[model samples]
Every structure is written in structure tokens, then in C-alpha cells.
Target chain A: MMHSLLVEGFGVQNWTYVLVGITFTLYIGIAIWARAGSTKEFYVAGGGVSPLANGMATAADWMSAASFISMAGIISFDGYDGAVYLMGWTGGYVLLALLLAPYLRKFGKFTVPDFIGDRYYSNTARLVGVICALIVSFTYVAGQMRGVGLVFSRFLEVDINTGVIIGMIIVLFYAVLGGMKGITYTQVAQYCVLIFAFMVPAIFISIQMTGNPIPQLGFGSQLADGSGTYLLDKLDGLSTDLGFNEYTEGSKSTIDIFAITLALMVGTAGLPHVIVRFFTVKRVRDARKSAGIALLLIVILYTTAPAVAVFARTNMIETVSNKPYANVPEWFKKWETTELIKFTDKNNDGLIQYVADESKNELFVDKDIMVLANPEIAKLPDWIIALVAAGALAAALSTAAGLLLVISASVSHDLIKKMINPKISEKGELIAARLSAVVAVCIAGYFGINPPGFVAATVALAFGLAAASFFPAIILGIFYKKMNKEGAIAGMVIGILLMLFYMTKFKFGWFGGGTKADWWFGISPEGFGTVAMIINFVVSIVIMKFTPETPKDVQEIVEKIRIPSGAGAATH
Target chain B: MSEKSNAKAYWKENIRYVLILLAIWFMVSFAAGILFKDELNTIRIGGFKLGFWFAQQGSMYVFVILIFVYVRLMNKLDKKYGYDA
Candidate 1:
């Protein structure tokens, strides 16, 4: 087999080069073959994508490097508290399928701002939508670029800056050349690559730990070593032995978890890039079906994540706890060279103590390295380790390409065609789209190379901002005919400003930088989106009562979208 | 039925379905997974605490099922309303 041939004599780094080369070639080939020819094709893949293909594309677009690399890693450390992300990220699709996708598909627009501008009958609302989309997409994409760089620097042994530049070039080639048509197909290929890459290691580790091939089931099964103790029971025992919370017991406040989960779900539904995927499908029903398919595909990884977390966490603790630094495995040293895993012999004992106590802890493991190092820790073959690098790249690049599309579409389509120069020709607009794409990729590349101090905080804040600004406006616009331009604009402005004030104050320590105890109603910045969204809903409705009703034709358009009968190709 | 009322009926039924499904969505994720987690954790299936299972695994599976169910229901409604075309 090609796998065996590749693994036979090549080192892990060499295998990474071969596999990454193959996958990148596949993506670029698809881009060249499926290049967009018209504005419609560029914006929404000519509005002819099959449901299944769109589903796969959306899955790839939705699951970023955070989902593939960091989610399991974070879960490994957070234990039961990690359920917030597991439930939060996936639950949003339910909201999308039920409340958003079909209606947006029926509206038949090129961008989220297009829908907002037309639905609210105001350029002001559209401009706000464009700004929000840009902020969310840009913040989200920067993280993805950094993720790409991280994989490259670790696996391929390149400078992180060089890795960023290479990733930028690849994404620029596909996104600028192929547009949505190109991105959609490449993402389908990427989804396959990433899912396979994720599952292979997980399945191997699951069987090795619990004698179960399925990771989801194996996490709840007994240890494979003739120990009758259940895996979670053992993990809980190990955790408490090391001064950590029990594996299955959460430490977060219930209200905070509820708020965060709601924020992420609403945010997922409100994200412009994910919503735009529905516009590519042929019909409203297809939109609904594809949302289902996307979530199903996403759930495959989401469910396995906690399991991988358990296995990796257990393996890591057993391998390093109280063990001599000299006896540590080669993988630990390799990661240590990357500085992601550090062992400081504070006690001068030369043994690695990985206890939870801040004063006594000797080993510091960065959460981002858990998934990347999982295969190696399990003694898996070099090829599987290389496949993970390729997978992480696939995750990062696909999401970056998706967010770049949103950024460019918000600019050329929303800012240029709608607001700035309505007289622009289709050809002119397509050129504008391509040019903005190039510019967006450059900016995204810059951020990747030189990430801002708040890149991580901003990525989470992107969700909060989306949930704050977009979800309420879109929801009221569809469900309530009385929703007017004045109401939505006011609601969005206040919601976004409130969310920004809260996030910056808490997350960035700006605006007189408050601590966690100062959080409003005990809701953390991550979960503040729920409060902002509720306020937006209330502000929109209350203002709508005092303001003028929606114009007659706009109400009729709302009626049309509700029926879902004729979801034709998206237009300008 | 008149077109106006016909559209209204379709939308109303759609909203009803959405409400029911969203209720299930909330039940699994927020209620069982968070608010009532400690209560549910008292019960265990295999090595999994019921609430922890819901939070980490069961809620996601239910979410996928909910979406597909919504799709199926909406598709049937569209057909019934003669909008499937």
C-alpha cells in the first residue's frame, strides 16, 4: 500500500512532507478545475451545489484548527468542564437548520449583509452587517493562520513566519483563483482528509486503552489490561490523586456553562460564513438537509474529542508523573524543544511533578500540544503522526479560506456593489471580489506571521460579537414582520457595543480592566453574548413598537421567504 | 385555501415544529447537561455519569438527530403545501 511504502524508510518529517504535499496538491488541483467564472459562481458556487457536497463543505468550513487540534487538548485538561464546548459548538446547527438556513436560502442573496440590507431596507444596517462580518471573519481567520503556522513549524521544521507565508500563498492561490466554487470542492476534499486523520489516531488509541475500536464507546469502557475498573473511574482516581478535579465532575458554575453554550450556539447560527453555505444549495429544503448533514459530520469529531481527551490525558499523566526527566520519551523531548512542554526541576529532584498546585508543579504542558502529540505518545507509526500534521493544516487552511471569502464578500459585494458603487458591472464586481480576496489574504497572512496579543481572546470574542449583533437582527427580521430598519439598527449597535465593552474589559483588561469577580451576574466574557443577545432582542422589539412598521414590500418579501417555495439562484 | 392563509398555515406549522425541536435541544444541552447535571449525575450507565454523558456525548447525538428530524418534517410540510418543487 502507499501508506506502507511511504512509511517504510522515511522519517516522520519526511512522511509529513509527502502527505502534506499530496493533500495540498489535491486541494490546488480541485481549485484549478473548479475555478469560478462569474460573480454568482464566486459568491455562492453558481447556487448549484448539491446538498451533500455543500454539507461536506460546510463541515470543513465550520471545524477549524481549534476544533481539530485544540478542542480535544482543552478537553483533556478541562475534563467535565469541557462539555460546554462539546455541546456549545454543535447545538448551534440545530438553531441554524430550524431558524435560519431555509429562510436565508429563500431570500437568495450573495452575502449576509445583502440579506440584512434588503430585509431592513437600509444601507446603514447593511454597513453594520458588513463591519460585523469583517470583524468576526478577520479575528477568526487570524487564529486559523496561526494554527497553520504552528503545524508547519512543529512538523515540517520551518520557521513559524515561513510557515505562515507558505500557508498564505496556498490559501491565496485557491481562494483568489477558485472563489466559492473552488473553495467548496477543496473543502470537501479537506473534510475527508481531516476526518480520516482525526479518526485514525483516535481509533488506534481507543483500542489500545479500552479494547474498543470505537472511541465514543471506548471512553466509557473498562481498561483493556484486565483491570476491571472503568476508564472514567480510573481517570477520576488518578485526577484526585494529583490534586485535580474529578474527570466526570465539573467545576464551572451552572449559569456560566448555560450562558456559554447558548452564546456559542447562537453565534454559530449567526456566523456569516456558515450561513452563506446554505445559499449555495439549490433549494430551501436542500439548505435544511445540508445543515443536518453538516452537523452529523461535525458530530463525528465532536463526540470523539472528549474520548480522545480522556485517553490522551490518562496516557500523559501515566507517562510523566513522578518519572525521571532522563527517562522521558523522545516525543516529550521533541515537544520540549518546541517549548510547548516544559519541565523545570524546582525541587532539584530531576523528577517531573505534574501536580495541579501552582507552587509544586514541575511540568507545564500547553493544551495545544495534546492532540498533536497524542499519536506519538501512543507509539503509533511515523506515518500516522505525519497524517495528523496534514490534518491540522487541512483544518486551518479550509477555515481560513472560508473566513477570507466572508471578508471579501463583505467588502466587494456589500461595501462596493451595494453601498459604494451600485453602478459597477458584474465583471467589475468579480474583479473587485478577487482583488479584495487577495488583499484579505495578505492581511490574514500578516496576522498569522505576527499574531496580535489578543488573538485567542478575539477568536472567542468573534462568537460573542456574532451572537450579540447578527442573531437577534436576523431572527426578528424573519419571525416578526413588525421588525423595522430603525429597530434592527439600534439593536445591533447597542448589542455590539455592549459585547465589545464587556469582552475588552474582561478579556483584554481594557476600559478599567476588571477581574472575574466583577463579571456581570457572574457571567464570564465568553458567556456574555447571551446577555447581549437578550438585550438586543428586547431593544429591537421595544423600539419596533415605538417605531414605524416595516414597509409594505419588505413585509411581502418576508412572506415570500417564509414559504420556501422558490429559492432560486442567489443574486446581487 | 387562499394563498395568504396557506402561507400563514405553512409558517405556523413550521414554527410549531421548530418550537418542539428546540425544546428537545434545550432539554438535552442546557437542562440535562448543565442545570440539572448534578441531579442526573447521580445515575450512571456503564462508566458514564448520565449528566456527563449528556454533556459530552448524548447532547451532540441528539442535536444531529434533531436537525435531521427538522429537515424531514420541513420537507414533508413543503410537499404538503405544494412548495417542494
Candidate 2:
């Protein structure tokens, strides 16, 4: 198994080690090249990146380790229901481009809270915005670090804790030194590495399975083994035979899925790390164009994910179903060592059985392992395996760097400079930002070593929190000129509290365990955010109607921002 | 027309474009992908059930296209309004 691969001097581990070393050096070099010299550069890359480069960096920032590593696995296991993620995450960009990005760019802010603060003209609203940003970004960074740890643990044979620490150090080196200026350029490089790594194995697997080189088309193509069956048809039949839902159909309640998808869409638009990227662009037009190009770059991976899921699912069934345990492939055995995949002879038979019914199923595979183990499962060359390892690291590091930057900015810019010490000098603020990044990376590393939840689930909570809290507040701040400070603050507090209450009540059983039946409208905790967001809108509109009008100056600023003109240099 | 009227008219046109684009965005995802998914699944496209395709693949493509379309339409609108950067 993996031991054999490790025994050879020029094996997969060696390749992975070399590639990771080279990639890390390249990223650090970029960081050094793009090093920040001013507060503006530290926060927003000196507001100078082109549309295309910003688009690429935004794509890298948006597509986290969860998207690269676990998305395909989730699709494979969850069947058609997983489409919620693909659509929800991507469609939000449309909302960003049309509704938020242009106006925010015209406003010319350094951070998301800056928009909320100025729009509402309230320090309290600004503070609330910063809290939400920190929570969402911190929750998200922990998952990226865990993704880094997982890849390192499997490929380098390091303990997960050591892997997390190593990842933290590397991110700390680039993120603290380079700031947004450094992180932005490094992310573009990471995007190239990660996407190349993602597509290679997918192309190989597709060619092997259906003689189709394009993974997107391979899923719908006929089997290459003369089976005269569409690949999905084969997977559907196999799934039904194994007591699983049909591959192209869903079994979850439609309402729940709908709510979750909506939550994720708004959440994506509301994300601080993503919103802040738009601030780094040179002009309002670049902001609009960048959103388009970012989605296009992102689509390259998002479109391929379902195809990878189909191939992995079909290959796994064909390879392992009804097979004797002793004859299982090396990849399965290797994954079993990590306990991500488990097998039991339930019927006292030596064969493994994978089925939907727990009583009859003999194999238990964690969904997160699918992407990490995919290249090995396909029996691709050692170099491809090494590439996948490097790609996963790139995905994890790129996202972690973005999230850490936002966290640092929230601390240094929003909390310290704006709230606590308004007179803090530019040099002092830059020092605080770098210091906050170091501290933030340390906390994120701790969470990576002791993850609060599974990678995708923890990331989902972050999305839900963002969707409920920030999305409504910011959208109202932009689109509803009459939305006053009182309405904005009230809506955000109520939205976040309701979401936290529901998640804690359901997810952790705080104030006693709440069952699905106890769920209001039968909405899952993941979907509850959408409902909470609705409540936020209702409360804000109602409160705004009863309150005094927004100040004349605030209304004038809103009118000006909507026009996308006079976007002079952003000032402190 | 006064400069104020020009800005006002331009904002109106911008809103119209956004509404049109967002309508398509909503239909493809929430309608074709979810509400009409069962009916769409009754139809097939290559190896894909139509609803399933919209859910996992089709909607995302439409999203990307919509944004780019927004970009193009906005660029024209910006030029007309003398807001081109």
C-alpha cells in the first residue's frame, strides 16, 4: 500500500515533497515581491490590481479548501441534492456584480464594515459589522487549516497537529509579511496550481472511464468498456441496487434544500473576505468586470466538480462493491489506515458491501476522503498524486491567507483604529495589522489541530452566520437609502442572535436538545439562516418606517454611490 | 435635460437592466433547478436529466454568463452616462 510508495527513493512522497517545496518558495517569493509599504497597500493592495488579476485572486479567495477537496465528495455522497452548493455559491456572484460590487467600489472603502459604518453613520453598526466579519472569517479559516492538515497528514505522513502547525507557519510568513498586496498575487499563482492539479486527475479518470478527455462531458458519455450504458445510468442502477437513492434524484425535503441554497447565495455575497477583494481594484468598472471574470475562472472548477463526483462514485462502486476485503485495492487499504474508510464483514462474509442501509452496509467511507484519495484510487501516476497534494495545499493556503487578512483588518482597521484609537498613525496601524495576522493564524492553527466540526459543516455554519447577519445589513445599507442606523443595528443584532440561537439549539443542543421536529417550519439549522435573514429584512423595514429619516448627507452619499462616478482615491 | 435628469435617467436604465438579468438568474436556479426539477427530470438531455443538469451544471453556467452580460450591458450604460473609467 502507501508504505510501498514511500519505500522507493523517487516515489510519490518525494515528488509531493519537492513540488510542495517549490510551490511554497514561489509563493513566498511573490509575497516578498509584492510586500506592502503603506497602510493602503497592507489593507487593499494599494487599490491598483487590474480586473483580470483581481478576478483570478478573487476566484482563489472564494474557492476555499472545502470547494477544492470536499465538494466533489459531498456531491458523490449526497447525489443531486449537492447541486445546492454549486448553484448557491456561484450565483451569488451575480448578486454581487449587479447589486453590491459597483456601489461598494464607488463608495471606495477599505473594509466591509467601513461601508456599513459610513452608510449607517453609526459606530455601533460598524462594531456589529466587524464582529460578524470576524466570526465568519475565523470559522472559515479554521476549516482551510484543517484541509491543509488533512492533505499534509496523508501525503507527508505527519501527525495532523504537526501538519496544522507547519501550515500556520507558512501562512504566517506570507500573510504577515505581504498583507493584501502579497496575498493577492500569491493567490493568482495558487489558483493556477490548484486548478491544474484539480483537472489533471479528472481528465485521466474521465478518459479511462469513457474515452472522453473532458470531465464535463465524460459523465454523460457512454462507458468505455462496451457496456452500452450512459455513465450516470450505470451509477443510478448501481445506487438503486445498493439501496441508495438514484444518482440524479434527490431525497431531501425540497423546502430545506431551497432554504439552504438561498442562505448560501446571500452568504457568499455577504462574505467579508470576498467583499474586501472588490475594494482592492482600481476603479468601479474594474470591480464590475472582476466579478464577471472571477465567476468565469471559478466556473472552470465548479463545473468539473460534479463530473469528478460522478466518476469517483461510479469508479468506487465498480471497484469495491461485493469485493472480498482481502482483495481490496491499495488506496482503500491506505485510507483505512487513517480510519477515514472502514470495512466490516457484517454477514460473516469476506466481501465488502456498500449500501444505504446501515444494517446491511459493510463499508463506511468519510466523504472528505474522496478528493484526497481520488488520484490514488484511479491509479494515476505518482506525479499526478503529488500534484493533487500540492493543489490541495494551494487551495487551503490561498483561502486561509485571504481569511486571515480580513480577520487582521477587522481587528486593526475596524476595531482598533476606527473605534478604540482613531488617532493611530498609518505606521502603527500597519504594525497592528501584521501583529493581528500572527495572532489570528495562531488561533486558526489551534482550531485546525482540534477542529470544532467537520470541514464542510463548519464552513457551512460560517456561511449561515454571514447570510443572516451581514447580507441583510449591507444590502439594505446600499439599496434602501432610507434604512437608518437604528434599523440597521437592530436588524443585524436580531438576525445574528436568532441564527446563533437556532444553530446552538439544534447543532449543540444548548438549552437542552432540540430535535428536527422542534425546528421551526422544519428548516434545518443550515437553512434557518435564510429564515432569519427574512426576519432581519422585515424588522429593518418596519423599524425604518417608524423611525426618523436618514440624514440628508447619508442619502446624498447613497445617491452618489449608485451613480458610480467621482470615485476618487480612497481616503482614511 | 439637466445634469440631474441625466443621472436620474441613467439610474433608471441601470435598474431595468439589473431586474432583467436577475429575473433570469432566479428562474434558472430556483425555477428550473428546484421548482420545476421534477418535471424537468422527466425530460432528458444526453445523459443528463434536465432538472438535474440545471441544478448541478446548467444554472452555474447561466450565472457566469449573466454576470458577464451585466458587465457588458453596464459598460455600455456607463459610457452613455459618461461614467466609463
Which model scores highest in DockQ?
A: 1
DockQ of each: 0.93, 0.83
lDDT of 1 by residue, A53-99 (tens): 99999999999988998889888998988998899889999999999
Candidate 1 CAPRI classification by DockQ: high
- Once fitted onto the true fold, the runs of candidate 2 whose alpha carbons sit more than 4 angstroms away are A1-9
Tell me each candidate's TM-score. 0.98, 0.98
* lDDT score of residue A165 within candidate 1: 94
The positional error of residue A160 in candidate 2, measured at the CA in angstroms, is 0.4
**Per-model lDDT:** 0.92, 0.91
Q: Residue A562 CA error for candidate 2 (Å)? A: 0.7
Candidate 1, residue A82: the lDDT equals 90
